[model samples]
Every structure is written in structure tokens, then in C-alpha cells.
Target: MAKAFASQGDMADKKISFTEVGRDLWAFTAEGDPNTGVIIGDDSVMIVDAQATPRLANMVVEKVRSVTDKPIKHVVLTHYHAVRVLGASAYAASEIIMSDKARAMVVERGQEDWDSEFERFPRLFQGHESIPGLTWPTQTFAGRMTVYLGTRRVDLMHLGRAHTAGDIVAHVPDANVMFTGDIVEYHSACYCGDGHFGDWGGTLNAIKAFDVDAIAPGRGDALVGKALVGEAIENTRDFVDSTYRPAKRIAARGGSLKETWDAVRADCDPKFASYAIYEHCLPFNVARAYDEARGIDTPRIWTAERDKAMWNALQA
Candidate 1:
């Protein structure tokens, strides 16, 4: 029998953990689901990547309350995916931050993404109806912006496009902790549905330039030390390479999408088969890789209609 479309069959709930990754940096992780990063400064708090819905984000809020009462002054968007940004209202933050490129993507396809992702992963959108609306970035930067909460500094930089064209990483130079949104996933499968495989590799290199002691990734466990951080970075790179390399070869040889998918699955499954979201993301990952390998520089927007059509074709 064919597999269930995307994550429709994934109904199991995951336990959430909040870990202090650095001096004042905290990571809120859910097994292998999307993760959120927290930074507490002397006077205020900043949250990276809000959860999918206000109700779900309330869990992160409760965790933040357990640590500090410094208001959640800012919420940052690593990219403009619904699961990442729709919960911005829960914080009532004074500023919602994202790259200008990210804001443009929201204007272009935010609604489509909202519908497409909600349909694919209903478990993640537990309180979808509670979301006020699309989260808008109050502040957008072209390349880099430094936000200071009293003496603490949070550097938001768009190194390059990886998971999405608007991806950004937050660096705390003093504490040496970096919140690398979806740009660097630890053990979790890198969802490449809207990714730029070639550019993502380069972006990972740029992330390596930072002298980070700890990193809170988009998914999986937090990297608490430099050694672990290095391993996580390489692991993420390995995943991308293992998936895209084979898919690219197949695509370049004029092979069909199924052939590309089969080639990548055969090569990467042994290594990443147990990773979080591996099964859910493989079809989309292979689809994007196949397109990029064939000279499609920009990722096509994934609509609800497109998602179903693609899933049906690929699953069969």
C-alpha cells in the first residue's frame, strides 16, 4: 500500500524539553518537531521562531515564564513558514523581526503556505483556529541587524539562502551562542521543500565562520558545546549532501522524479532513515532537489493544490 500523504498519518505527540544551552540562552525542543530558541537579556527576552499556533506557543510562553519575567520584547522569524510564524501574536511582542526577503515571501505565498502546511501536518497545527492572522514582521533588515536588550546583543544575519531564501541566524557574540533557525537542523531531517540545496551548503559554511560555543537548531536536540556544535553542523551537511547528491545525479541523467527519489532514498535511508520527519519530508526533498539539479534556481511556491498533486504522483 502507498504511504499516507505527508504527515497526515503522524498522530503521535512528542514530549517537549526546555534546556539552557548557554549562559542565558534556552532551547525549547519537541522531540523532532520545530524548535524555538530563547535569549534572556538583562532587561528583556527575545524568542526565535514561534510555534505553529497561539495555543502551542503558550507552552513556550510557560517555559519562558519559568525562567524570566523579562517581557518577550521581540520575536524573530528564521523564515516565513506558517508553522514558524503564525504564533507571533501569543507573545504580543513589541517587534516581530525577519529579513526583508522573508517579508516579501510572506506577501507572495504566506497564505498558500499556511493552507498547504496545515493540511499536511494537522498534528502540528493543533490550535490553528487560535492564530490571529498571518504574522507580519514589524522590523525587517536587508542583511544584518543588531538588537540590544540592555547590555546583551543579539545579531540577526542573513548569511545566504538555505532552507528558504529569507533564512536568518541569530548570534549572541558575548555568550557565543547562535540560534541558527532552520539553516542548521541537528538530527532532524532538513525539510527542503522550499530549499536551495546548493546555496544551503554555502550558507552552512558561512555559519561555520562564527565562533559559537553552543547552537540552538531548528529541530532535534540543542548543541551545547563547540564539539557537539561541529558534529551537528557536519551531520546536517551530510544529510543535505546525501539527499541532494544522488537526486541531482538522477535528475541530470534525465531520470524521472521517481527515479530521483528512489536513488536518494536508497543512498540516504540507511543513514537518516531514523531521523525525525525523514519519511514525511523525503518526497518533497527529492522533488526540490530534482528541480534544482535541472537548473531551477528559484523554488516554486507550494500551494495546497500543488501539494496533493505532487504527493499523488510521487506516492504512486
Candidate 2:
């Protein structure tokens, strides 16, 4: 699951696992592959982050049916990313929900981002034809929105921006669990190409404010305790810090971008080398680091053309 514009497909490098982290809360994760969160309540189900296509989403739907026949009431997107939000139409939920910022990203650069991601990773979008175009949320919120599947309450909040300007988390107080989108990637690579570094750090800090007993990150296993939660946050922060420090150092000294990338790679690859999507993510990660190193805080919007050129330059 290299974050760079690599072949988009299901990550077949490792085994996939779906774990129930709390009561009626499940993390549909496959190593570093895209993960879908499930919330089953008294009356219906709520899916967090649809996979790449309806076909992929159905794989999750199939799994959901295996355990319960509850109707899926809503699809909550922590933020908008082609891989994260595209399969939303498959749920047939009453409404697709997203933060106002997430919606704006979709509106602002959805198509371009879609093209860029599709070109980068084709496997993730295996059933490309099954995707019903860009996934648009019927219900949008600014800060936070509380929805209930019968009496069970699920809180969606955009604590701050990190991975993207619209990143959010789904917290179920009763369950004592939280599903963080790309805001927390667990042991997987953190795709920061379209990210705001400072804001992303803040987002992680905000997530810690919740009294979560279990945590489901964007990818990887669902952590069971606060120690694991602490590990997730610390590892993510270290990755980000290691990436940014070199980018900043190189950019300030007016050093070569590739050199900066190599330096960061030497550092991060050693620690996260065996982590999910390391190969797929490094190119884009380096590019983003280079940009941030030069004080480019807000990640530049990625386009299909840009995707190709960047990959050729790095991987070539």
C-alpha cells in the first residue's frame, strides 16, 4: 500500500483480518489494505468508509450479513479520498454522511484526486465499473454530528485536520471505541501527500482526548487497549516527524529533493520497512515530504498527469 501512485489493487502482500474491537463495532482491515468500520445497533447498521467500489463494499456487506441482517442506515466518511469514499453507493443507506470539509474536498478536487488515485493503484479499484462515480454525501456537517441506530449513538467529529483538511473520527461512547480514518493508520503507511502536517499532528492529539478503550485505525489490526492505542499514536507521530524533519532540513538547505527523500527513506524504511504499503507509499511520501520540507504546508492537489510524472521520476 505504498502511498505513491503505484498500481492500485487489493494489497495481496499480507493476510487480511477483520476484528471486533468493541460491542457491535468491527474493523474490516486487511493488513495495509483499505479498512471499513461497522457499527451494528439495535435497529440498523452504520458503515464507516466504503471501500473502492460497490463490489468491494458488498464484500463487506456480505460479511455484515453473515453476522446480522440489520439494515445499514448510514455511511459515515471520515474524509473524502477515492479509495475511502467511492464504494458508498452500494450500502443503500438512508443518507451518506461526511464532514463539511470532506465534502468540500470532494467538490474541490474529487475528480482529479479520483483520477490520480485510480492511476496510482488500480487493484484497490478492481471493480472500477462498479464505482458509481464520485461518492457524494447526502448529509453534511461542519464540526460534529450525532446519529443513532435506534438507541445506540455514534458521534462523528472533525476534531482537526491532519491527513486531510476534513479528517474526522467516529466515537461510540457506550462502546468505548473510536474509528479513526486516515487520522490514524495503525501499523500501516500514513499517506500524507494531500495532508497538512501541523494540522495532522493536532488531529492525533485531539483523538487522544477521547476515553477510548479500543481503537480502529484506517488500516491494520484493531487495537484492544490504551497501550496499543499509545503505540499507534507514537508510531504515527514518529513516522510523520521523521518524514518532515528531513524534508524541512533539505528544503531549508536547498539540497536535492531526491537526496532528502533518500535520507528520510533510510530512516523510515528501516523502522516501517515491513509495514503495509511501504513500497507503494514511499514515492508519494517523499514527494509530500519534499513539499513540506520547502514550507509547502498544504499539500498540493494531485492530478493524474502529476501522478504519472511523479512516479516516473521516483520509481524510474
What is the Å distance of residue 65 in model 1 from its true position?
0.5
Error of 1 at 78 (Å): 0.7
Task: Specify the poorest-scoring 10-residue window by lDDT in model 1.
Answer: 307-316
Tens-digit per-residue lDDT, 1-316, candidate 1? 9888888998998999999998888999999889999999999999999989988889999999999988889999999999899988998846999999999999999999999999889999997888888989999999999999999999999999999999999999998999998888877899999999998888999998886899999999999988999999999999999988998789877999989988998988899999888988887898999999999998998988989888887764
Residue-wise C-alpha lDDT for candidate 2, range 1-316, written one tens digit per residue: 3333475544465466778999888888876788899999999999999988887888888888888998998999988999999998897745899999889889899999898888776777778887768889999999889998899999999898788889889999898899999888787888888877766777788888785898889888888899999889878888788777777778788888788878888788778888777767777788987887677867788898887777777766
Off by over 4 Å in 1: none
Return the top candidate by lDDT: 1
lDDT of 1: 0.91
Return the TM-score for each candidate structure: 0.98, 0.94
